[model samples]
Target chain A: MPVYSEKVMEHFQNPRNVGEIENADGIGELGNPTCGDIMKIYIKVKDDKIDDIKFKTFGCGAAIATSSMVTELVKGKTLKEAERVSNEVVAEALDGLPPVKMHCSNLAADALHLAVEDYKARKAGKGPIGRVETPEHDENEHDLLEHA
Target chain B: MKIINFDHFAATKMRPEVREAMEPFFMQEYGNPQSIHTLADEPREALNKARLQAAELLNAAANEVIFTGSGSESNNLAIKGTAFARMDKGKHIIVSKIEHFSVLNAVKALAKLGFEVSEIPVDKYGSVDPMDVKNALRKDTILVSITHASNEIGTIQDIKEISKIVHENSGAYMHTDANTSCGFISTDVKELGIDMLSAAPHRFYGPKGTGLFYLKKGIRIMPLIDGGIQEFGRRAGTENVPAVAGAGVACELAKKELKDRTAHLLPIQKDIVSGVLGSLDEVYLNGHPEKRLPNNLNFVVKYIEGESMLMWLNNNGIMVASGSACTSKILKSSHVLSAIGVDPALAQGSLLISLGEDNSLEDAAYFVKELPGVVNKLREMSPLYEEVKKKNKV
Candidate 1:
C-alpha cells in the first residue's frame, strides 16, 4: 500500500460529506479520469456563505482524503474564506500527502475555488462552467517500475 | 484482526522444513564452500546438494545450475551475459514486451551497446503468439528471451513452441524468466526446450537473496561478476549457504507437492474469478482464464484507482497488490497491462491476488466477501461512478 499518513487514511476510510447535493447551487469538477484523478465538488450557498458542501472523487487515497479534507475545511464558511483553501492547505490539514501524490491528487481546494467561481458566474448571469482544466500528464517525466 | 496475505508473488513465508534444512548452515556448519580447510567439507557438500536439488526441479544436470543473488541477477546474467558472449556472432535480441523489468532493461542496455532488439507484443489475454517470435527472429538474432508467466496478469506463455521456432530458424539461444512460474507451474527446461531459465526461491516459500539460474550444458556466457572461481566461474561470489540450503529444500518440496498444490489452488482461483466478476459491474479479468497460473487472479475495477482499494482491503485485514501508478514506485502504471491493450484509465484499477499453499479455501472466500465492500466504498466516492450510473440510467 502507499505510505499514507494516519489522518489521510482516516479521511479516506470515513470521508466527510461524500455524495452530491441534488440541484446544488454550484458544482465544480477538476482533473480528469485519464490522468488517474478526477474530483467534483458540490456547494450550496446562502447569502455569500457556503450553506452545505460535499464531494465525489475518483482517485487514489490522497485524492479522496484531500477532497474530504477540503470539504470539511470550507463548509459553512463564506466564499472568501473558502477561496483561501489550496492544495497545500488541504494537504497540511491531513498531516500531509505523499510528495509524489501531492501535485496530482491534492487539488480538492482548486475544485472548491472553481465552485465558488461558478456560483459567482451564475450570480452575474453568465454561465455555470462544468470543469476546470488540469495539465496533461507528461508520460516522459516518470520512470516506470513493475511493482512498488 | 487476522492478517491474510494474497500477495504471494512478491514474497512468501519460509516453510518450517526449509528452515530446518537451513539451520545447520547459519551457525553450526558456517564455512566458506571454496575454502580448502577441513571445515569446508560440510559447506561444500551442502552447496553441491543444493545445486542438485535445484537442478532436479528443472530436469537439468546439476552442473548446469548456478546460484546467484536473486532472480533479477540471474536474468541479467542470462541476457547480458549471453549478449556479450555472442556479440561477435550477432547483435540482435528478441524479447516479449511483458517480461519482467530485469529482462526488458537488460535488453534495453544491450540496445545501447549497439545490439538491436525486437519486442514481441501479446494478445488481449496477454499470450504471446509463437508466430510473432518466429517472425521477429533474424540472421543476427543471437538471443530470444520471454517470460514463462506474468506475475501481474497471470498469463502463461507457450515457451516450448517459441523455443522450437528460435532453434529451428536461427542460431539464437532461448531464455525465459521463469521467476513467477518455477514453483507454481511446470518449468522443466527440457519440456520448455529453453537454453536458459531464471528462478527465485522466495516466491516458492524459501529464503530470500538466493536465486537459481539454469544454463543448458555446453552453452557459454560471459560472467557478470569477476572474482575467485565460484559457480563454475560463471558467477563469482561466496555462496549464501543458509539461503541455498533453504532454497534447495523449497525446490524439493515444490517438485514433490506440485500436483496437490495445483489441485488445491485451481478451484479457489476459479471461485474468486467467478465470485468477484459475477457480483461487480464494470469489473473484468486481466489474464487468460484457463491458460494462467493456478494461484493467480487479476482484475480491473472501473472508476476507482487500485491504491485506494488496496488501502481499504489492507485496513480490513486482507493484503493484496496492485499495478496502479499510485502504487508503483515510479508512478507509472503497469506496462504489461498497456502491452495487452488495457485502457490506461482502467489499468489504474488493476488488482493482483496471488495465492500460496498456506491460503485456504476459506481465505479465498473471505477475499471474495471483503472485496465487494471495498470496491463499493471506493465507487461510492468516485465521480466517474456517478457518470457511469447516470449513463446506465439514461
Candidate 2:
C-alpha cells in the first residue's frame, strides 16, 4: 500500500531547507505528537513575498517529503500565490503520496496556509496565532493511540 | 542487490532441506489425504509423518497436534474454539495485553457476544506478571491465552509460572501463542503445563501457509471450520500437503539446531546491542535484557520516525521492520510498545531487527556501522530534535 514515488524518496533522502528560522515573520505549526507527526514551518517575508523559508518536521517519509516540496513550491512567491498552493498540489509535485499518508502527513500546504494567516494576523498587530488547538486527550483517543 | 535481511520476524527464507522435503508433495505425490484412491496413500502417510514430526518438536503426542492454515488461524482455533466449547460453563476469558492481534482480536469478537475479557498488563520490560493472571481469573473464566514471547519487543514471558497459576486457580483451559518462540526456544507442552499452543511454521523457515496447534489430550474444543473429517474432525479443510511437509522438516531442523543456533546468535546479539546502544545517545532497547529471544533486537531512537530510518537502511542494502504508525496499516504505533508505557511519540520511532540462521557477525557489524548516519540524517530534519537541543543549551 505504501509504494512511495521515486520523487518522494528522493526528497525524503535529501530534504531541502531543513532548519528552523530563529526570528521569522510568521510561523505555522501543524499536527501534534499523538498523531505521530508534527510540522513547524518558518517563513521570512519581504514586501509580501516569501523571501526565505525553512521547515522542521517530525514525521514519516511523506511528511518530510511534503514539507520539503512545499518549501520548494512557495519560495520567492508572493503570499497570495503561495496561499493558492494546496495539499493536492504538494502531493502532485512529489508525483503522489500513498492514500493513507496523503490524509495524515500531507499537511505541508495547510502549514504554509497557516503561516500566511499568521503573517496576516501579525501585520494587523496581533500576536502569533498560536499552534492549532489539538483535541484534549481523551480515553478513546488514548485507546486509539495505544491500540489503533 | 545483496540484501541483508534484519527483518526475520516479518518473513524468513525457506531452508533448503525444508524446500527439498516439499518438492515431492507438490507434483509427484499430489493427492488428497482423504481420498480412497491409491494416489492418496503416499500423501496420507506424508501427512501423518508431518504431524509426528511437529509433535516431537513440542514433546506432545502426534494425535494431539492439529495443523491449520497459519499461526493466526491456529490462534483463532485455540481461542475461539475453547471459548465456544466451554461457553455453557463460563463466558469469561483472560489474555495478556501484549498478545498478537490473532489472540486480541479473537477475544474482542467474543466480547461482542456477551463474553467478558480481562487484559493482563505487562511490566516495563513487557513481562506479564503471574499474579496479574491469577487476579484476572474468575469463577466463570473459560479460557486464558498468553503469548510465550513477544515478536515485537522480543521479551520471553514466564509461561511456566503463569501456566502453573492458571492451573491451580481456575478450571480455564490454558493456551500460549508460541509463534515467535516455537522454533527458537524449547516449547515442551508438558513442561510448560499448557493445554494448547499455537505456532507458525513460516517464522522458522518453512512455507508460509501452515500453522501448528497442540491440544492436550481430553480437552474439548469446538471447531472453527465445520466440515469434513480433516484434522480428526477438528479443523476442517483440505490439508496444505506441500506446506505441511515443509513445516515438518523445518520443525525437525529447528529442534536439531536450536542449541547451535542459540550459541551462534548470542555473541552476535551482544555485539550488535552494545555497538548500537553504546554509540548512540537517547536510544534505548525495548525488551528484557537477558530474557529476550537470541535473534531479536528492538530499539527506540529518539527524535526520528521509524519509516525514515527503515528507508535509509534499505537504501544501504539492509532490510528491517518498524512499529511506527507510518509502517502500520492502522496508522497507530504498535500496541506492544504502548502496553509497556512507551510514549506514543517515541513509539513512532521503533526499530526491530530480527536475526536468523543466515545472519552473520559481519551483517550485524555492518548494521551497527550504518545506523548512526541514518539516525543523524533524520534527526537533523526533526523538530523534536531541535527542541531537545534548545533545552540542553540551558
Superposing all C-alpha atoms, what RMSD in Å does each candidate have to the true structure?
A: 2.3, 2.8
Q: Write model 1 residue lDDT over A46-141, tens digit each, in one string.
A: 988999999999888898899999999988998899998888988998988766776678889899999988888887888588877687566556
Listed models, DockQ each: 0.61, 0.47
Pick out the ten consecutive residues of candidate 1 chain B with the lowest summed lDDT: B324-333
Best by lDDT: 2
Q: Return the lDDT, model 2, position B112.
A: 98
Candidate 1 deviant stretches above 4 angstroms: A124-126, A136-148
Sum up the clashes in candidate 1.
0
Q: Which candidate gets the maximum DockQ versus the true structure?
A: 1
lDDT of 2 by residue, B262-309 (tens): 998888899999999999999999999999999998899988898888
- Scored against the native two-chain complex, candidate 2 gets a DockQ of 0.47
Residues B1-394 of candidate 1: C-alpha lDDT, one tens digit per residue: 9998899998899999999999998898999999999888898998999999999999999999999999999999999999999999999999988999999889888899899999999999999999999999899999999999998888999999999999999999999999999988888999999999999999999999999999999898999999979999999888899999899999999999899989998888888888998889889998897798998888999888998899899998988999987787566788999999998889889998999888887887888899899998888888888898999999
